[model samples]
Target: MYNDLSNEELFGPSDYSETSDSESNNEVSPCSFNEPINNISYTTFPSISGLILYENLLSHKQQNELINGIVEANYFDNPESNQAMCFGTLPSFLLNAIEIISRVPGLFPDEIQNREPLFDQACSIINLYKPGEGIASHVDLPRFEDGIVVISLLSSCVMQFKPLSVIEQGDDNNDNASYYNKFKDIQNTDEPIPIILRPGSVLALSGSSRYNWTHGIEENEIDEAGDEKIIRNIRVSVTLRKMKQDQLLLNKDDSNSFSLEVKKREH
Candidate 1:
């Protein structure tokens, strides 16, 4: 069904704005949170730059509301789509989630005061995953700028990140089997950094972490997190990004070729 839709149609609108009159031009305080929120923990990976995780960012009630909204909206009604996207303004249910993310100090830059504190032009991609289904290692589309944010819901899983060199030696056709093999082949010298993403956690990627690393999940019903094994369940990830101005109208194939150009440039 989305085949006939333009990129603008796939997303809400290309000119969509996240800024509001009330938030416009107001200087945000450095300490946005008045009191320390319980169960909140911030972490970073030394091996990967600009990789940040904010655990327990949403409470149980808030997480439930978001999950309920996504399900009720039928964003993934078509079994084939798997992914749904929203641009500009967000649904009413997600307004509070974005507000909370915006308050995280230095999570998003304040130089762009006219737009939303989070991103210049915000877009969200909602992805649904069934048990045992996992994504392959790949860099995010270069059409999107840095500062990729992902919010996990409903289950816990390990996301593995490897350097671009690992992917650069693989086939461009994106054969998942070969990719997985390559992932396992470098365990000793270049072990992939595994990050545990639990429900209600937010992961942000930027700089080298965003461009020079490939992240993916292995296909398995159970995942190893630390010394414990986590059983996979129905999970949803909401990824937020700032779209590049010129790439708004690119079709799927165009985006793929553009990604190739990015990879070539990295070499």
Candidate 2:
């Protein structure tokens, strides 16, 4: 029903580090992206944050290309977890993204120079929504967590966040179990904060959205003017972040060793 965005690099590939088996330190966590929802400010439901992207990330042509089935060879792969590293082949974009993300306040200074230059190669992720397959509105867990840089590719879609109430958000006591639970009836809630996104748009939302609120893509339809009539468009976004494993790989990223917070799941 929508268009996919694709782009060739304005900037070229980057100088990333190579690691042997035991070199876990330089390896950034490949967010397997499972457990798609979690605890947070909006208990009954996740609060709302609008869509965000950098104007310079992608050129117009690169941003509005036709999206078809992505070739499997293009992404990072983990056979065991059925995940691919979407960012692996595109070190140039990933590196540029790191420079952008480091400017955010929460991203520590040391973390940027050491880890960002090496730890994170790129992000690898894919989102598929059927006629009925859609996400309920919810906040992302662990606010202000990673040094995040996200790029959007594929079909355009609507993502929304519902308004939160005083009674809705509970105290954040830094507890794991509490945050793990999903409270609000996220499946089609109300008071939404909404935005539509296009391909080639890059969003640096981790500094804010990951913790403060909940957001989701609404079930939608598509209409094409080209050869195709209507097809449920797929969206593939690559999110780059400075996580615990990234810091560990580059010892200079932090004064202390990497803490085991929000570790990457198997991929």
Candidate 3:
């Protein structure tokens, strides 16, 4: 739960309005490219359903504040190793970030928006990555429900997404080997769709994009953004998720079959 903060504190007073004048008969607004809220623009990838990139979601000052907060927490004691911290509850330091996101109209599902606290569980994973360090392609744990939000800070990186190929576990009792091969084949393919995540950008994933695709960054010192090459830097990513009521454990059988659908670059 959060205290009542004025719209001026969340967004510039002149940029946002808290009045009901914009709402006609209490109709909810849909998050689309045509209708941008709070001077924030977004790009949606056709290749992956429910994948949205909210560009410049936070100001430079806000980004710095988050980075400083993470540093002060002493979560990154070893500068040489990649580390991650998981939170079952929302930390006081992250309230500002969550508040800023909740202020954006129509970015989340209606039911979620209607909730008083927005997210009930408010589980989060904060990852600190050094240059040339990257994570493997994998899906989030099944314990989390849909509507996963990721906010990137400090430096920009390229994240690639590829649809998973279904492999029936029938007769193949070795699930580990099956999953390893599937991920290896999917990631080794040349048809992955890459998206550049700039500083203070928010990436939302749900539906097919959330469940059917594998997203990860490559281990490279340099990443390509269109024609320009960006040198990788120390970066921090905050991934927010809501835990399911059942708190189900990871299910290897939940992998769904998906076909390739590569859409043109829209970012």
Best by TM-score: 3
lDDT score of model 1? 0.62
Residues 187-219 of candidate 1: C-alpha lDDT, one tens digit per residue: 435677888777777888888788778888888
Model 1 Cα RMSD, 1 decimal = 12.6
Candidate 3 or 2, higher lDDT: 3
lDDT of 2 by residue, 1-267 (tens): 232322333211111222111111232221111222111101011232322333223434333321233333333233222233343334344444444434333223344434534334433344444333345555443332344545556544555545544454544544434544453443434555544444554554543355445565655575332233333355555556533554336433333321211222221
- Leading candidate by lDDT: 1
What are the runs in model 3 whose C-alpha is more than 4 Å off?
1-37, 111-117, 120-122, 168-190, 248-267
Q: Model 3: per-residue lDDT, tens digit, 143-211?
A: 566777889877777888877656411122334344444454443454778777777778888787877
State candidate 2's TM-score.
0.47
Q: After superposition, how far is residue 257 of candidate 3 from its true place, in Å?
A: 40
Local lDDT at 148 for model 1? 77
Model 1 regions more than 4 Å off = 1-39, 108-117, 120-122, 166-189, 248-267
Error of 2 at 210 (Å): 3.3
